[model samples]
Target: MAILPRSQRLALAAQASARPVSVPAPITGWNARDALDEMPATDAVLLDNWYPDYSGCAVRNGFVLYSTGVDSSPVRTLAEYNAGATRRFLAAAGGKFYDISIAGAAGAPLASGFASDAWQTVPFLSRLYFCNGIDTVQVFNGSSFASASFTGASSLAFIGCIQYQNRLFFWLPNATGFYYAPLNSISGALAFFDLAAFAPHGGNLTAAVTFSHDGGNGVVDFVAFILSSGDCLIYSGNDPSNVNAWSLVGIYRISPPVSPRAVCQYGAEAFITTYDDHIPLQQQLVALKLGQLPPRSKVSTAVQNAVRANLTGFGWQALYYPRGRRLIFNIPNADGTFSQHVQNTALQTQPWCRFTNMNAYCWGLFRDNLYFGAAGGVVYQADSGNLDNIGPVAADARQAWNTFTDPMRKRITAVRPMIQAVSGETVSFGLGFDYGDINIALSPTTAGAGSPWDISPWDTSPWSPDAIVDPRWRVGGGTGQSIGVRMTASANAPTVWLRTDFRFEQGAAL
Candidate 1:
């Protein structure tokens, strides 16, 4: 039997009473809403702790202890400061902000004494600004951190802030209005851009973002305001102070945004994390009068139904990691656990996978690396290695069950998972027949030290006799017409899942 490796197509190797079915790693990614047999072969029924790469490739997501050992707590907000030639990363916990740019027992808090720790920060004009609508706004200019007190800044207590059209834009938390400072001025006089008169549904302002669009004329910047009732007010203009220049484009409604940071910049466009959908700003802007959704982006279609139930949960965020070509959507569970629905934006199909062991409360990018703030008052850098600082990275994937060749009861004789080798690493695997649950235990093997150059294998061996995975054919026990491959694996190095080979014997057709 010969197994051919194609893009995502299955290569069959038929032998006497044997069916060698090559199951490729699902680029169609995680599907929790669809039926077992109704999904494509490239879709996963259960995928966790696995980070999908460009192709149908995945590596066990790993993170080391970037910063920890302060008071045990949850790092709810991760903030970044961008200086012209350098960058600074900060974390918020226990009503204080710490300099997490360096990895260690987080040094003395950069700024403290806040009633609330959940802050929204943005870098503008070579400084980092912080706001939460509870306390006075603060600013950090690489060295000094203090309350921003300008001529008219004492009354500027907004929940969020962003730099749009060479100006500082802010939105009031419980008011259906927004305030904008003068062009390129972070201080001095502030102008109120009231949306309460424009909001048809009439709810408090939730967030504000600057959206860039082309309407057959040229590129223009539209100031977008999101309301608690899902009313979105889009306006086109650079200056809001000039009444004639600022015009209300339209007021459309969408799902209520999770937070002020629900919208993330994605290259020329942006993505909004709504309660029920991951809507693209450009595509949404191009829609009809009501800003209806267009053809599915398939970005979060598979798992959105499950995510809808947890819309009210805290710690929801959307981040676009340009360095990793990823769009990570952090989901908060009712049980306090967190999982990320990651989309590989590099791929045209935009395959998505669920990542376990990444209990991220907030996300930030600095120095072109991905970092997440989680519990324990710690911030960890992702994609660092194969092992997590919190614990071992346990990956589990259940392929879509399907009846191959003929619809007949068959016995799964044996199965072999073709995994890319990383010297000597342990791999625990098990099988699930029909829709049964699968449990795979850990049995680690000692790592192998590569042989020295020009060293003879017969004369010298790296270490002791190790019963490594070898990924040899293991005995599989399953008796059903539809079969699925269940694997749980982890390593300290990059791991690629090519495909799984199945050997089966057909029995009664009925």
Candidate 2:
């Protein structure tokens, strides 16, 4: 082969140039990695109020009027008691519990004078039992809210409780064992079961999570007692008081929970929110034995660096909303503010997302619907409509950098965020260069003046059906080796993101 001159080769390479490439929008959800610039193109660098979907990122549903003005203090907990066809929703705040079933100002305090704000509640035998580590175990029997009549445990102030094997079990703070009542008996003398002997790490029991496991031979229900030292004692039995009926499964040490409320049960599997990660208790055992990462570490691996400071923060809790198929983990800050790390479990990958402007202190379910207790004396029904209460939802997303493995710098010239909007919506377009957050201020969004550029022409498309795709090309300008497109919108009408086209020059030495 004949050798080409250096100038000729350079000229040929320059002439070939690089073409514009379009990439599907990120749907694998928010990735708060240490090196966000290195994340996959399908993962979001910063995503809020938008859920990851297989087709694209979709706007989240909003909250509506539930109840408010319970007290000046924060509404710490929301609970429900369902008996047959009737369901009653209750709100707790300022050391008092109120009946807030209807949408209005909370009714008078149903139960008052409690010391702690946190309460562990479980519904059993047509009534609900509560434990707060400071107050006597309170029982809400649909009408009355008062202390239980357990004869033997009158002096015990239980911190947490769960219904396992047909018994109401209670545990105290800084104690290795727990208290349980006889089977099928809600009001009776309680029996003490000591776990100090079986637990290996010898730490106090923090919480009990009840779930079922299927190991090829049908499903088996188990209650997992989580120790503060990360030791978990799982038991399978109906009667703990009977030596022959009760038995210990195994004691495995994993990441301890941030709080007693950090464990969330979705269907049959329970997810434990620990200092380092959110993983299933069953998978944690297998991962520990096989020396592999828990399959669901994706929940925390993406936000490990971001959540490291919040592992010990207050108001850390997880709740599963079956109506919306969302698994929400509440992360509170030192300033009394909070954000939610939510996952859409309906999706196969169970993609993650972050939610803002919805500062929920705790979550509860009533009539198979989701509701959350808020900071300023209120309870809002979440996943109800297109707007977050009254204000619009601020949907923001930052796509991973699109470098295409090129070492040379590039300049992004334009971006087209295919959005399906009702009527016409405005979306701000900003471009972040290099590897960090974008610095360019987005220009005002203007609707397309000309005919639509999609498959169907203007008149033929469904007129004002729900929403239609707007193919307006946004003019963007930035210079860097990597370019990440940031799309932001605050609208009452929810929208969908289809894909993005990054039109740019490949080699710009300047």
Candidate 3:
């Protein structure tokens, strides 16, 4: 693998007049989408769960993060084995905080803690709601917790439940229907909404619940839930008549080996996740993109069609979209490596993957690389050429002709000469800056044709004269700002003897 001289490569870039290549600015950002600042002390490690909150990144403080086991319990908090980290916290019955993070090993006590036995779930909010049993429900506020009493009625005990919009709902194991509360609304103090009329038969217990805004169009909102039997159900939020009712719009029966975990709705499409263990670990991606909801049906076939169409391929999983960037997907390979792909490109292609010993599970996008949390509390970053396709590359190409205001200073758009790799043995590029100045850099890659070699005429004119300057052009106006050379690629040409450099600048000046 011989390295090509930058001079020769410069010429090759311009051999063609019609086919021009424009480099893209790379995609760059931070790591860990759900990274928490001011993490708790190491000794006091607790179970962590990410919930959808309206306030962007402010789900903590106001909400309680709990731990299931105690460090003192030998069996529960053994020194080895992930520090006994399988903790689960949920809004449990009787407003008690269910500490499920501890390992219920032999000879280990439940671990002593404040209000552990007195409260079933911790009080993270002013009001608490949970299912006491099948056909029984309870609501407890500060008053209820103090008095050890509830004001709601008992309804069918739900096998599983979740709360949204301040109302809690549950499902019956049989899936025949759903029972909602407060079962007994005595006077006006307690409230109850009977959704028995809206329940769908054969609907198993829902394992997950999520909602999606209607893409900000005010068309309709969405409610999606996954059942234990691996079935998915979706409903439209536009039915003003049945505000609490959910119409079964559509269903997907994924059988034989895939367990769906997360569900997200984008626009009118629903993305479902399947657990995988392939080389790079496959995440079975299934989508449902919608066209229009059915007239009288609870579920919309339009939505189902959209999902099925998007899930047309296997071995694809859509990561949660990064806040500032477009949708970048992780395409997994057989060797535990993955590439990030941009859906916005016509070349909806995935990046190339090269294994680097351990797997690179992308936690976040940084500058031009993906950052991963390694096995032993160490962090690693990887560059898979994802940046070459976007970000800095594109910005670099655009900067050649457009005026780039120093991002740190005032809003001054400066343009310069477009760097064009010239013809000859020693090919060089002329960079015209928006300020009428010229600069150059060697192309590190390929060196092209046209063999005269000497391009001295192109180099000395650092800034072109005013008479020849295009009236539309303006003078570049800054010192710290880039007015000259940026980057260059070159190659060796035996016949011609010359070294060349290319430069980009704002536009011609005034």
| Candidate topping TM-score | 2
Q: Per-residue lDDT for 508 in model 2?
A: 59
Ranking by lDDT: 2, 1, 3
Residue 60 in candidate 2, Cα distance off native in Å: 1.9
Better of 1 and 2 by TM-score: 2
Give a tens-digit lDDT track for model 3, residues 122-178: 112244433323323333342222222323434344344444333344554445334
lDDT of 1 at 258: 78
**Local accuracy of candidate 1 as per-residue lDDT tens digits, 446-502:** 224333222243124222233122446766666887777666666665555656778
Clashing pairs in 1: 73-377
Which regions of candidate 2 are displaced past 4 Å? 1-18, 299-313, 405-409, 440-466, 508-510
> Candidate order by TM-score, highest to lowest?
2, 1, 3
lDDT at position 217, candidate 1: 95
Instruction: Report the error of model 2 at residue 427, Å.
Output: 0.9
How many pairs of residues collide in model 1?
Answer: 1
lDDT of 3: 0.28
Candidate 3: lDDT of 259? 19
> Comparing 1 and 3 by lDDT, which wins?
1
Local distance difference test scores for all models: 0.72, 0.79, 0.28
Candidate 1 matches the true fold with a TM-score of: 0.85
